[model samples]
Target: MGLLAGCWSAAATAQALDAPNVVVIGPNLVTSGQPTAQALARLSQQGFEAVIYLAPSSVPDAVGTEPEVVAQQGLEFIHLPVPFGSPTEGHFESFAAALQRLKGRKVLVHCQVNMRASTMVFLYRVIFEKESPASAWESVTRVWSPEGPWKRLALSQMVKHGIKFDPF
Candidate 1:
């Protein structure tokens, strides 16, 4: 009976999180692909206080009304706009700053499909949150592995922090 309950609980949690490629690092931290307006409402119900969007609103698939939707749901929306083809270290700094301010609050960092969001979250996890590289790596790679510019950014941050982990 206990095993059955546990399985049911896991299923319920999965059902509750309906965003694309959603990853729950903990109760307070989540990363995902673009959340629809309805999904944003669900996130509000789930107790997320802020949404950090990494992709530019100009992206072909991005939701133009995302900011307004998040506001209507009473969640703070922070868009850092990391370009998919040319993410920079400075961009990471801005993201880190927003997260630092919202630290300990329920925050959702997302991009179109979790690739950019996951990589930035991985860096913030290892460097700012002081989590083990392996732990953070596992949290992110489950969504999508970083590559090219994204992978280079992650590797550079690791080097800058003097942490060692080889994902390549």
Candidate 2:
């Protein structure tokens, strides 16, 4: 019975950690495709301190009440409104700044489907966190390869930050 109970608890913990398109990047960071209100509620329990949304709030299926839900959960919410087709350096700058401000706090970064979120996290990890470029790029590719504007934005941010790893 003890063994069975232990397995059940482990399974329950894993279920609780589940989020839309969830990618557990590390202890301090997670990236997801989209965030529902219910998912936001689970964040605090999962040890997240804040959320960084990389797309506009209206980008198809976004929970319109995210701010309220996040507030209710006592977690900080920051929407960066990155346009999927035209991501700019300004957006990355803002993301990096917000992330830096929240340093050491567990943060969840999400976009419509993890593409934008993954790339941004990859860049942040590689540049600011001194993560291995190859390893961090693995998480980004697990969602999707950044192409078009995403590719351009990723490369440009790398250059701006003086990181020379070409993950393309």
The candidate scoring highest on lDDT is 1
lDDT of 2 by residue, 32-142 (tens): 888666777788887788989888987778889888888788999998998889988888889999999999998889888899899988888998888988989998887
What tens-digit string does per-residue lDDT give for candidate 1 at 38-156? 78767777778999999999977787888988898899999899889999999999999999999889898989889988889989999999999998899787887888998899999
- Candidate 1 to truth, TM: 0.90
Per-prediction TM-score, please?
0.90, 0.87
Question: Where's the lowest-lDDT run of ten residues in candidate 1?
Answer: 6-15
Pairs clashing within candidate 2: none
Q: What is the Cα-based lDDT of residue 95 in candidate 2?
A: 95
